[model samples]
Target: MRRYGPAVLLLLTGAAILRISLLSELYLRYVQAGLRPYLVVSGFLLVLLGVAAAVAGRREQEPHGAHGGHHAPRIAWLLALPALALLLFPPPALGSYSAGREAAQRAAQGVGAFPALPAGGPVALTLAEFSSRAIYDSGRSLTGRTVRLTGFVTRDDDGTWYVTRLLVSCCAADATTNKVEIRGADAPPADAWVTVTGTWHPKGSLGTDGAWPPVLDAASVRRVAQPANPYERR
Candidate 1:
């Protein structure tokens, strides 16, 4: 335990940093709708565990000289579980679950701004990427071409399903949900991962003031599952 203390502490610290980073302002706005409470709880737990690990490291008994005692290497292996879990079953992406909640919030405030996409190429973007670009271009840049996207299903509403990709600045707590509307695909189970191939059509009438009115007319949709690391980097 003593020999592995530093590594454990480092892991905990790294996790904490990740969580805090995801909870930043831009990301937090969307994450708050569905995950704020859970994140708060998780944050508290992480803090407590971090403190416990620090205290334990300080209280541990010192090892004797090499001739007297050799530290056991087995304790270092204990960290494998968490490392494996993160590698294998990373938490699901923010999908349909956050759609309605976020949409409602955005509606109340009016749709936010978006940027224009550059000319001459199919934009390969995540929901977050498109959203950020939309802020600057308002869908003007993506008017007539296909945009490829991938994300998890968050939830479904009346006749409309919302797909989302999580953009995390640090960790889940700071993660933000970027949403896209699927107009005519078979609805997959909520939280299922998927890739969407479609064209962006400006929703001329449905857009909020200063926001681009556009929806993805999905040509094909395929379901998958969350990846090892679920967050999109800034």
Candidate 2:
């Protein structure tokens, strides 16, 4: 039992992170939806490890001997830190602070041609999808189509305004941003979520290795609540 004390702490620590990730949607801040299965499996494995260690320790008991000497107390105490931090203060989702530091990462197109847009006046698309077409497809597919996009606002010191969203390759640490330069309206306050209706501005051009985000000739802008899933996974 005593030999497995640290294992128990490890189990709780892993489980606590998983619990917060699932129940509180804290996982959204750190990883893609695809990783949920791996996280679940890992949490269960930690619990099983602790249970096995506890059972084995019980069977190996020396009636008069201490299961674990005092030296291990510090290790067990240290193992509890992450678990305690998770319980006390859940980590905040990536916000303006993170978004502000990111660079322009929009592309002209993705791997292949975009699927046909709805046969109508305008097609609503994600900031990522719109930017991809703007940068990669040579303005062929989106030459005259109107697009509606929803994302948070970001304004530069030079007065440039952008409708922006984050795209995470794997985790927050690996997050890239998708931004559409709003051509007309004065940008709202930073991080204010909004939906914009716009046309692609061809002047943005086929993106070079490090070109800035394409521009959108915005027709209208509407305020919206921030979405539950803020990052686009690719």
Candidate 3:
């Protein structure tokens, strides 16, 4: 058991990775969809390495120690705990706590014209696009059009609440929050996913702090299941 500690740890870790990336879509919670292939390859390699190491260990003679064979450090087994935990219970996607911790950072794009929205009412848009157009678009494309947005609910200390989503460039570690303050509808439980349908409520002039968060006069808030890939890409 002592001589096989490293190989066991490697096998467990690799199995955990494969469980998340190859067996299920759970990997989407932490990484971009495009990286799935890479994760699969890495996990396969790790499993292969673990098998090779175990075979090599078995062939090699173990030096005799006071007990019998050389003993591995007790701490070596601790490394397996995380892999086991991940295998059995993977972490949930970043949610309200993550969104609330982020500071409001408006996009760097200057106030400018946005392409005309497709002719329609209740256009479906990502929170990032909605925030960008609401805060920086001089055209005010969202002014009269009803739009639909989906995100998890997050509340402020003052009873104010938002429909928030995290934007990620590569992985969960780089996630940033993009949220819109809800005006009319009562907020669902914190971290509950919802689809908000409403018209934009204009605030201060575009591109100012006052315009931040971009209010939405929600007409209807419907509870929805969290998406498989919750994070919006940059």
Best lDDT among the predictions, by candidate number: 3
lDDT of 2 at 145: 88
Pairs of colliding residues, candidate 2: 108-132, 108-135, 108-136, 109-136
In model 1, the worst 10-residue window by lDDT is 103-112
Per-residue error at 23 for model 3, in Å? 0.8
List lDDT for all candidates, in order.
0.58, 0.75, 0.92
* Model 1 residue 156 distance off true place after TM-score fit, in angstroms: 3.0
What ranges in model 3 sit over 4 Å off?
66-72
Give per-residue CA lDDT, model 1, range 1-234, as digits (tens): 554465564555445434533443222423433455665566556656767777777777766665433344455555656644543444434555544454321222333445555565556786756654444453356667778788777554475675676666555565555677777787787778888888875554434434432368888898765654455665
Clashes of each: 25, 4, 0
Which residue runs of candidate 1 sit more than 4 Å off their true CA positions?
1-122, 135-139, 204-214
Q: Whole-model lDDT, candidate 1?
A: 0.58
